[model samples]
Target: MKTFYWLVKRELWEHRGGFFWAPIITGGIFLLLNIMGIITAEVLGASHGIQIGASGALTQVIAEMDSGDMSKVGILLDVAMYAAMGLLIVVLGFVVFFYCLGALYDDRRDRSILFWKSLPISDASTVLSKVVSATVLAPAIAVVVGIIVGMLQLLILAITLSFHGVNVWQLLVLAHPFKVMFNLIGYIPLYVLWALPSVGWLLLCSAWARNKPFLWAVALPVATGLLISWFGIMGLFHLPTRWFWTNIVQRSLFSVFPGTGSLFGGTPHNAPHIDGLHALDLNTTYQLLGSPDLWIGVVAGAALLAGAIWFRRWRDDS
Candidate 1:
């Protein structure tokens, strides 16, 4: 158990730049842009009575909260928080994609796999460590960094609003930082489950490809789809080549919240009308967890992961 833990830790240590620093840097850039926008808004508002768009909306929401109805304010901030998280998720997803693509291949390319294999560890453990790092540890790190960066950004916004005579406490009341953080944390497990198939597939390619794992990871699927389309085999099978690509993309992107409508699916016409701070509902989470697609993907991912381990054990990179 301790060895497994250390293996996972080693993966994190090696890929800290991608799994850790990338999100932090991206969040820092977002924070800087937000601060600069606030400053610009203050200057413009002072000279021309023009309101900063985001702050103006927030200020209005805060004003409405004085009337004893704080729900709208909370909902607005919740949506904003989700928007920020969505951006961070996109960045994290890309990092994990490339990280998995190269996880096994890089060791062999640099002849480090020889040293790793000489250790008293099995290939399964080594591959599992990379999988856990990409799917679980990497996302966890990104989420924590994102939450911290979010809190800091909101704190700055609150202070800036207070300077303009907007009540900052009202903003905090609406923010519901604890609730937001909890929901974001809850998303981590769902994301791991949702993204497993893609991650496992990448790991398989990483272990199996003799060279250019990225090309194998990306090109093979695309080429297969293209060949099927060109040969009209897809038409005969009643499965369009586009469906193959679309399904993979949707599975990769939308598996996080299964019952909830996806960004790819377009907003549902019957979407719930939330009038208050959107706390993570246990019922909705239960429904998402019960999804058949989620289970199917998990099974597929497990098969691919098994293939990866087997390939890594037998393939001689040197």
Candidate 2:
């Protein structure tokens, strides 16, 4: 267990630039842009001899807002929080994609695999450590960083509004920070389940491909998808085209993205909510977990991961 912990830490140390700094840098960029935008708005408003609350209309609007209106503001801020995190999650897809695509092959290319192979560590432990780092630790970092960035975003808004005398504390008070954190962080386990196939598939290519694992990982599934569509195989087999596209192609390629439980095909259009603004909140996730399709992907991803482990042990052209 101690060794496994260190193995995961090693992966973190090596990939911290991607898993940590990428989101922080992205947040920083957006923060800078947002600040610039606010300054521009203030400058323009000043030129017009009218600021946000100069006419007293904005202040009166907030003062007149009832509980229902305040709740609406809270919902809007929750949405802003989601938007902040959504940007980071998109970066995560690209990060984990390339990370898995090179996780094993890079070590071999640099001859570091030989050094590791000299140790007591098994290939299974090594591969599984990468898996845990990609699935759990990566998303956890995104959620935490997203929360921080989201709060800062709100702070900017509050400060901007404060300069205009519009009861800025209400803006901060209406936001549901605890709920936002819960929802963003809560999605990680479900993301792990949804991401298994893509992670496993990319890692398998990383282990098996002699070079250009990215090409192999991308081309294989896409070629298969094209072949199915070109031959009209699904029509002959009485299966919807979407079934293969979603299950076979997307599971192979895009399962790394969150909210992919929709591919599982068990949740209703009107599924219940579990205290999050996202369509794929806990309630919807619970429903998707019951789908046999999801479990089948889980099994396939595990098998692919096992193949990755096996290949890493023997395939060493690099």
Candidate 3:
């Protein structure tokens, strides 16, 4: 158990840039851009002699807005937070994709596997540690950072509203940031499942490819997809080419992307104004467990991951 912990820690130690700093840097840039945007708007408005603070028309809009309208405002805030998080998850996908692509290959290329092979650790432990790092730790860090960035963004929004004489406390109460945070955190486990296929595929390529693992990882699925499409067009075997592209090729390559898990099934259906805008519907999102595709992908991923471990155990040639 302790060895396993250390293995994961080692993975983190080596890949801290992808697992931690990528998302942190992304969130920082996002906040900075938003702040600059607000400042620009304020300066432009001031130059135009358009004062927003306590304007009678603006006050009238606030005064006339009912609970429903206020909830819409809250949804807007939720969307902002969701957008920020979406960016982090996008970074997570790319990070995990390349991280797994190189996890085993790098050791072989640098001849560091010789040292690790002298250790008591098994290849399975090392490979599984990378999996856990990609699916669990990376997402956890991104979510925590995203939540912090989100709360700060909300604070910025509230201040902006205050400057315009709009009371934002009610919107804050309705926004349910804590609920949203919990929702993002809760998605991590399911994300692990949804992500396994992509992770497994990448790791398998990493462990098996002697050179240019990235090229192999990318070309295999894409080439197969192209062949399937061409044959289908030529009236071969009546294969569902479109379905194959979407479900197989795409999932194998891109399922590590967050929200793509259930393909936006997490969106809150209760938000009528936005017609299914941001936020997690735990009930609906959890329903993916009932999906055969999810489990089928899981089985395939486990098999690919097993293959990765096998290759890592024996194939050390760079």
Candidate 4:
């Protein structure tokens, strides 16, 4: 158990740039932009003879917020948080994607695998640590950093509102930043499941590719798709190329978490009208858990991970 902990820790130690610094740097930049926007808005208002300390749209918005309803504030805050999180997700996704692509291959290229293999760790442990780092640890770190950045932005906004005669307390009471942060955190475990197939496949390519894991990881699936399309065109077989691409490959690669709309309780194309703290719906979670595609992907991922372990164990990369 201790060895496994150390293995995971070692992955973190080596890849802290992706798992830690990327999110922090990205979040910090966004927070700075938010502050600058607030300042710019205030300056523009002043130029237009709008008193910062006078009742205006902000006051009206606050008045519309039900004094008894906290969800209104939460939803309002969610908009900003969602925007920030959206960027974070994009940046973090790339970070993890590239991290997974290089996790094993980089070691071999540098001849560090020789040293790692000489350790007491098994191949499974080594590979699984990378998987856990990519899926679980990376997301967890990003979420935590995102939450902090979000809270800071909210604080700055609240202070600005107070100076402008807006009811800062009411805004804070309505926003429920803590609850929003918790809700975001709650999505992480499900995200890991959603991302498994993609991450696992990347690991497989990382472990097995003699060179350029990135090229092999991307090219193989694309080539497979092309081959399938050609076969379908020639009437060699009945292939639902579009369906397979959309439902399987795209789902694995792009759907970081299935039923994320359920988290906000809205359709994918429409934003949810946040009326209250929409706690994660267990039914949606259960639906994902019971999904055939998810399990199929999981099985496939497991097979790929096993292959990765085998490649790591037997292939003489040195």
lDDT of 4 by residue, 1-318 (tens): 888889889988999998899999999899888889988998999899877557677687657656555565667776776667777888888888888889989989999888888888889989998888887888889888888888787788788878877877777766656666766777777777767778778888899999989888878777776876777753444646775565455644554432342442123334334343353443334345655666676777788789889998998858
Q: Estimate each model's TM-score.
A: 0.86, 0.94, 0.92, 0.86
**Models sorted by TM-score, best on top:** 2, 3, 4, 1
What TM-score, to 2 decimals, does candidate 2 have?
Answer: 0.94
Once superposed on the true structure, which residue ranges of model 2 sit more than 4 Å away at CA?
262-266, 269-280
CA RMSD for every model? 4.0, 2.1, 3.0, 3.9
1-318 per-residue lDDT for model 1 (tens digits): 899999999988888898889988988888888889888878888799765534667567655555446765666666656656666787887888888888989998999899999999999998998888887888788778878887887788778867766778766777676777887787667767767788788889999999998888778777776786688776776987777666664554334332222333333346565333342543344344555666777888889899999999999758
lDDT of 2 by residue, 1-318 (tens): 999999999998999999999999988887888899999989998998876786778989988989999899998887877778888888988888899998999988888888889999999999999999999998888889999999999988888888787777868889988878887777788778778988999999999998899899989888988888888889988997777888888888888876656644556557554454656455555677777777788899999999999998888574
Alpha carbon deviation, residue 133, candidate 3 (Å): 0.4
What lDDT is obtained when candidate 3 is compared to the true structure? 0.85
lDDT by residue for model 3 (105-193), tens: 99999999999999998889989999999899999999999999999899898889788887778557768788788789999988999
Model 1, residue pairs in steric clash: none
Worst 10 residues of 1 by lDDT: 257-266
Please give the CA lDDT of all the candidate structures: 0.74, 0.85, 0.85, 0.74
